[model samples]
Structure formats: C-alpha cells, structure tokens
Target: MSRPRLLLVYPATHKLGWVKRFQLPSLALKQVAAATPTDWEIVLVDEVHEDVPFDGNFDLVGITAMTHQAARAYEISDRFRSQGKTVVLGGIHPTVLPEEAGRHADAVVIGEAEPVWAGLLGDFLAGKLQPVYRAAIPDGGQLSIPWGRRDIFSGKQYLTTQTLQASRGCPYDCPFCITTNYFGKSFRYREPEDVLAELATFSGKLTVFLDDNILGDAARAKPILAGMRGMGLKWGGQANLRFAEDPEAVRLLADSGCIGIFVGIESMAGEHANHPKTGSRYSQAELIKRIRDTGVVVEASMIFGFDDHDEGVFERTVRFLEECKPSLPTFHILTPYPGTALFDQFDGEGRLLHKDWSRYDHGQVVFKPKLMTPEQLYQGWQQARWEAYRWPKIIDRVMQSPGKPVHLLYNLLRRGGISRPQ
Candidate 1:
C-alpha cells in the first residue's frame, strides 16, 4: 500500500530580486496541508526559487497563483492533466473567477481553504469530486494555526524567512486593491493567544506577518502586541496608517518587537480609487508623521498615475516622500490587475496597450495614462524611482529613522548601487 502524495506548486514569474531568492512557505497551503488526513505525503515546490520536476510521482497537485501568473499556472495544470493526475486551482484569482478556473481544474476550492479543503480531498478519494467547493467563512472565529513547516524553507534565503499570520481582510474597498474584494469589507482577526503560540515556533530574528492589514482591529491588536513583546521577537507586516490615531496601540506595537511596518500610502496627492466620486481615506502628510512618531520605522508604498495626476505629479510626489522621511519608500506605477475594479475601468476605456502579464508588475505601465503619453508615463516612473533612491536622500532618510543606526546603515549600503533601466 502506498501513501497518497500531494504536490503544492507556486507559479513562475519575472519579478524583483528580493521575491526570487526567498521563497517562503504559503500559509494558505500550510493550513490546507495541516487539515489533510495523516495518510497523505506532501511536497512543496516554489518555482520562483527552485526547479519543479515533473518526474516526481504524485496522486494530486494543488497550485496557488495570482493574476500575473495565471497563464503559467494554467500551463502546469494542463500538463498534469495530460499525465492522468488530478489538479486543483485556488487562490485570489481563482476564488474570484471560479467559473473560468473550473474549466482548467478537476475541482476548484473558493474563498478560505481551511473549511473546504478536507472535504475536497475526501471527495476526490471517494470519486465524488465536485466542480467547485466553497469554504465557509468562519463567523466570529479566527483561523486555526498550523504546526511549523520551518523545514520547508530551510534552503531558501529570504530577508527574513520566519512567517506567521495574525489577521486577514481589509475594511477599505480601494478600487485598485483586490484585498477588500477577496476578504470582504469587514476584518477578521486571529486569537491573540493563537497568534502568540504560532510566533513561538520561529527562533529566527525576523518574523514576517503575512496579513493584508496587520493591525486592523485595535482591541485585538493590544493583546497580540502584549504577547509578542513577551516573546521578544522582531517582526514586520503591512498595516493601515490610521493605527497612529491611538497612542496606546502605537506604544504597544513598539514594545511588542515590531521593528518596521509597510503601509500603503497609495498616492502622495490622495487621488486614488479613480476620482472625487470615490472616497480618499487620509491626507498624506498626516498619516506619514503619525506612524513615524510611534517609534516604529515605516516602509511607505506609493502608486503613480491616478487620473488627477499630470506632468507635475512626479516632482510633487518626490517632495512628499522626502518630507515624510520614511526609512524606505517604494514607488510603483498604478496597475489594473485582472478581477479588480480598476481592471474593468481600463478594459472599458480601451486603455490597455498589451496583455503581457509579466509587465503587470507595479514597475511597468500596462496601460496608457490618461493625463500623459505612454512615453511620458514610462520616463516619469523611472525618474521618480532613481531620484528617490539617490545617495543623499537615502542617507537623510536612514539618519532620521527611529531604528538602530547599524540597521539603517546596512540598508543604505545594500541600496548604494543599483542600475536603472535605460
């Protein structure tokens, strides 16, 4: 008798250097694997960091992919099907477009995978698999924590390999963002005790919290921070800027081993989510200073090319970032990824220039900018990135940051020399 084998595949893509080297375990897959019966043998393949061998024998294949990698994911699904093996597709893109995905997969798991995963596997073994299975959203409950699969990432070199999840979903429905659409308008939190227990497994210096919005709920965050401080761990994750509103929450996070956080500033001029018809969340200057005062370093992310932007946008954006003085500033062109509200807008307006998924990365302009020519949009993006990362500005930002000087210096040296696209 042989044990059932499961192959978990992460799709291949052309991406940033940081994304390629450190292929961390997908917590979504980990949770699904944890729910499987003991008789199954599992193997993980992250094509971004490793070579995926088709020769390996497996009873079932599960692949998770985003919009950019949908083409490659479908290719893999087709290849496995040709080999007379079962393939299942689930993730953000698939969950939103299940009807299209079901055409490629023998079965598709939608929404949260935990509640529906076991049933899907069971049905497959019983030869009663359905075309689509939806996971029930746990009401007033957090996700069940899985045991550490630390061995899975042992060979990979990421900035920090330790990964954990404490929360999910975003309350704001920004047109360009897919998070709110996938997770719902209301935020869901993990139990503080559960989060602490999960954090205890990693002995590494850096703990990455894989959450859409880490500090979404103030009440839940207080206890979670208390527990993290007790553990003495240094962690990072994405969060909303509104966390600065409550002084107590800020203090708790600093005490709880939070060295840095990534906040989506969206745009320097507060002109995101289309036009004045759609609401803008916060003013740029207020949000940046409030987060910095908490003693927690910030990595601010801003998007370019909102409808309101024009020729003057680049210089204004750079000045806003310089004044904010975040430890690191990430600038990206506005991208209309498939399944998002923005994608529909681009499609309707016939602004999309190409369907090449590789360039859909925030770096490239996949569509024409309404206010500027395609050439202007490209040049503006490159100029903004190069200017923001210049030596003098980098030094000033590092010097003003709240973290250890050595850490800041290390980042400065790491970023000292990088080529810009010609």
Candidate 2:
C-alpha cells in the first residue's frame, strides 16, 4: 500500500573549485518536485553537494540537465536503467535533442514540465508511460504555481537556499542564447502577490532570484520589487543593462535590499556593443558606475571569441575590467549551445571543433573563431580570469563596491584559488 518513490537528480558537471562551489540550489529540480503528484514519495539529490546513489531504492528516476551536463546525465540514466529502473530526462539539452536523450532515457519531458508532469506521473503509475511528453507554452495561471515540496533541500549546505522566480521567458532572441528558443519570446510573470507570498515563506537571510532576466519587463519587476522592500532580506539576480536607464526601477531594486546583480556585458567591441538587449548608449564604465552608485554590487559578465574580437581581446578585456572596477568581473568563451542560432551558423560554416557535449561549457572553446585561432581564444579566456582575479586587481575591484564586506568576501573566495580554470 506504499506510494511509488521518485528520485530527482541535478547532475554535477565536475568537481567545482572553492568559489564555484558557492552555488545556489538547483531551482529546476526543486520546481519539478513541486509539480509531482502528492501521492508519490520524492527524494531530491543535487550532485554538487553529494554523490548520486546508483543503488538507491526508487521506482522512477528523473534528471535535469543543461548542455554541459548532458554526458554525465546520460551516464546516470544508463546506470539507473541498468538496475531496472524507469528513467526520465528533461531540461534544455534533452528538450532540444530528444532523440539523443531518448537513446538513454525511457521518457523525455520536453518544454516546461509543469503542464504535463501530473499526466506523465499518472501514465507511469498506470504502466503506460510514453516516450515523450510535450507541454505547451505556459500562460499566466501556470506562472503563479507554488513549490509544493522544498523539504528535500531544506538543510543542504548551500551559500543560500532561498531561491525564487517571479517570471519566465525573454522577449529578445540573442544568437548565442537558447533561452528564447526554449522558453519562447514572450515574457510570463507571476502575480506580485503570489511572488511575495512565496518570499514570505523563506527564513534565509539572502535570496537569489533565478529568473533569466529579473527586470526583463520593467512594469512587472517594479511591483515585485516594491513588495519585497520591507522583507529585510538581501537579494541578487540577473538583469539587462537597460535596467539602469530606468532610474525608478534602479531605486526600487536598492530599496528592496538588492545587494548584487549579474549583468551580461557580452562584448564591448563589436556590433554586439550596439544591440538593444545588452548594449548601452553610455560607456561600460558609466553604466556600471550608475548601478553601483545605488549601493548594489555589479558582477559584470563578459564573453570573448566573437568575430569582431582579435587576438588583443584578452588584454583589452582585462583593461576594461580594471577600468570599470565592477565588484566581480567574470569571463567566458563564446559557446554555441544546440538549438541556438550561433550553433546553426557554426555548424553550417564548418567552424565547430567538436560536438563533445561535455566541452560545450562556456569555459571551453567549442568553435573556431573568425578573427583568431581556437588556442588563442582559449588562452584569452584564461588570461582574462588570471588577470582579473589576481590579488591586486581583486582588491581594487572590491574597494570600488559600496557593499565592501560582501564584495571582499566574494573576491577573497576567487583569490582562494577556486575560480582558476582546470
């Protein structure tokens, strides 16, 4: 008379360094637990913190993966299936390449799992699970869905366990981004009251909003921020530079206890510098200053290996970071993930080096650069990290932020030799 047991896994890419280990809990896996039928017994495992139990007792196993984690995910699926357990694969990688994933999993849930999760579970219990279950784009009602289960990760050692999402999807379709293709081009937001109600449930001192762009829509973000003002918890999330142009929104963010933001300043040298979503009319230095002046830390994210970037990009990028003095300056090589326009273009031009899903991580060079060799691109990315995270530079960047304690702690972590490329 016992209910069926389900194992939910968030696969780890590899052993992370000290600083990278300070990651937020897997919001996607937790959300999947939220959507599962109440009658099922759920066990969540985030591989970043613990090892996967291949011999665990469970009737069904579910895993979520991105492009970088696909190889490990497939291996995990094979292991579970070898033990005569039913396995399900979901997330961007599987949703884009279902056939490849299906080669390993018994079923693949494509798109948002909320709409079809109940049905998928029902059919599974009925012994009639299908090979694929596709859910349509979610509407407003789906946006306000609650996390029915969080007890699975309640006591895990994470930098912060408080995570919430107020919205989904992005309207812009950047070539290197798969978000648009996966989540669609329309912004879907949960009601402000619903978001605040969820926030009120968290007892943590800090919260991390996992939205692709927390302020993608200014009107929707304002109310959410306003509601969070008196909550007395520090928060951070990703946002486009355009948020700076709206002074009111910037004020609301600070008033709402937003201590940090991750901004994608992808490329400062090319036509990308002029694109609407990421581009800014003001210089990078000015825009960063404007945001930082609001007592919020700016973690500037930049990408190299664009067609317009030459061999000198590494030093130039380091120089820009030094000049901008963001609280943290993170760099990445341009990775063309599957289902993205960049991937199609690279595949067509025969510029892709290999389809090794593991190396598709942004740290590795997966495609040939238009202006430099792959070696140069990889070296540039490493050199940028080396230069930016060096002790002197880290100290200088930390001094620039108004939130000195938090910035200093973050910089010290990077300097602790955690972020260096393996």
Candidate 3:
C-alpha cells in the first residue's frame, strides 16, 4: 500500500514577489504538520511564493487562512474538493464560521488542531472521516503543543524560520478583538524549559515568538527570557506595553537578546485611556520611552476609527506619536473582523459596509465610522501613514534607534506598502 501524503497550504490573496522573502512561514500550518503522525509525508505550499500543486497526489489536503484570505481559501478548497481529495479547512475564519466553511470541506477543525488532527487522519484512513472536529477552548492552564515542525518549511526563504509560540490566549478581552472568543480569556503558557529547548535547536540568532503577547504573564515570560539570556539570539516579538512597567522584567528582556518589540497602543482617544491596557496617555508614553531607552526598538501600533474618534483623530494620533517618539509608528484602520464584539455591534447597527471578507483587512475601512465617513477614515489612515514616514520623522526615529540600519529598513518597507488614493 502507498504511504499516506498530506498537502498543507497557506493561501495568499496575491503574489508578494521579493516581499515574500521577508514574511514568516505559517506557524499554524507547521504546528498542524507537527501533529501529523510520523507515518505520513507532509508537503507545504505557500501561495505567496509559489503556486499550489493542485494535481499532486495527496491523501489529505489541509488549508489554513485568516479573515482576509477567506475568499481565496474557499476558491482553493472548492478546486481541491472537486478533484475528490479529502479537504480540511481551519483557521480564524473557519473557526468563527464553521458552517460556511463546512460547505467547502470534508472536515473542519474548530479550534487547535493538535487535539483532533490525529483522530481526523485516522478516521480518514479508515474511510470514516467526519464533518467537524471541535477542540475545547483553552482557558487557564499550561498549554502543551508539539514543537511545530520546522522541517516542513525547508527550502522556503523566510525572514527567519526560527519562529515558535511560547504561549497562547490573552487575559484581556478588548471589544474589537476576537482573541478571547477563539482562544479563551487567559494566558496559557508552555513550560519554560520546553521553549528554551526548542531555541537550542535553532541554528541562527534570528527568532520570533508568535505569541499574542509574549509578556502577557510576566511571571511565565521571565523564565523563558532568563533561559534565553545566554542563547545569543537577536529576536523580536509583540507584547503589551505594561511589561516595561517592571524595571527588572525590562532588564531580563533586554538581556534575552530581544532586539525589538511591537506593542498595541490601540487608540489615542480618552475612552481608550481608561482601559488598563492603555492606562493614561501620560504614562503610556513613559512606558514606551522606557523600553526604547534599553536599546530595543519599540514599534507602537495605533488604530483609527474608534467610536470616540472624530474627524480630528488622525491628526491627534500623529501628535501623540510625535510625543512618544517610538522607534516606529504603525497605523491601522480599525477592522471589525468576524467573531468579535465589534463585528456584532457593527452588524446590529447596520454599520458594516458589506460581508466582503477580503476588504476586512486593517488596511481598508469596511464599516461606517461613528464620527466620520468610511472614505474619511481610509484617507486619514493613509495621510497619517505618510505623515509618520516623512523624511524628517523617519530621521528623528532612526536617530534614537539602537540598530539604525534595521530601523531604516523597517521604515522603508512599511512605507513601500501601496495605498489606494482617496
């Protein structure tokens, strides 16, 4: 009998050209590949780099996608299923709307796939494949997942293939976020030793932790940072700004070869300040400066189009970034993604423009703004983006950055993103 083969796909909306080299390979697919029994051969096709081998003789086809990739993903699924291959669809989009996805797949993994992947494959081999496999939402507890299979990404040119997740889930449930819905309401960490051991296998110094917040649980994060102190790995990851409040934690983070960190500022509106995550505007700037002072680049992100935001939001946000002077400022239009409170509220109010998932990406405005037109929100986003990347502003930021070249590279790359004219 021929050995079983699995083809995992990372669908892309469009070709990325040289930009694909800087992107990270899909960690979600890697984890799925890891959970596959050793008996099966796994092949991966990242649509951004190469075309999917639709005619490949594979026993099982697995495709993962985020909200914006849903259209392309569904198209790919339909094509594969038409060829008589058993298909599975899972990811943020499908996990939120499994019924819609079920219409296109032989099976849908509702949550983390590791819990049911083996069983699904078994059922398939036994010719008893089911339509749905839902894993329970992980709440408070340690998270144990197979170290994602890095070999599956072999021969692929990514910025760094040494990416892993040390933890999952977030404690905070922001109205605009779906994290709590899809990944429970608490931080579930892995053993520090396991994370360190995985790092030991990484050959190079370039590593990235694809966690919701690497420092969400400072207690759990410290141990991993301590172990990585001597690893000599220059890494970057996202974390809540609150982490810098503890001086010792910042020291440990700096010593752990963390070259940069991305933190969410969300919005500059006063309503946002009341939240513990944002705190007061005065202190948020202080915290960002504290992290940047440690020779670590801090990429502070801001989203426009909160209910409290008005026509002046774009200028006000640009002013705040001027004061904070973070190493970089990332501006986004607030996106009401499915499976979030924001989406529900928008839909109930009939504020959503349409159910076109492709335009739901943060780069585009997909809802009517409470205080401004959708076109205004989009134009403001574009204007603020150009304002932040202006020659003088970029120079000011790069001057304070520890790694000047890296800072400039990031600035250029972010600026290169094409913006549709108003």
- lDDT against the true structure, per candidate, is 0.75, 0.84, 0.89
Cα lDDT tens digits for candidate 2, 297-332: 898889898878899888888887788888888888
Model 2 pairs whose backbones collide: none
Ranking by lDDT: 3, 2, 1
Local distance difference test, candidate 3? 0.89
C-alpha displacement of 139 in model 2, angstroms?
7.3
Cα deviation in Å at residue 236, candidate 2?
A: 1.1
Best by lDDT: 3
Instruction: Output the lDDT of residue 153, model 3.
Output: 86
TM-score for each model:
0.90, 0.94, 0.97
TM-score of 1: 0.90
On the 0 to 100 scale, the lDDT of residue 347 in model 2 is 99
Q: How far does residue 66 in candidate 1 sit from its true spot (Å)?
A: 0.8
Identify the superior model by lDDT, candidate 1 or candidate 2.
2
List ranges where model 2 is wrong by over 4 Å: 16-21, 138-142, 269-274, 417-422
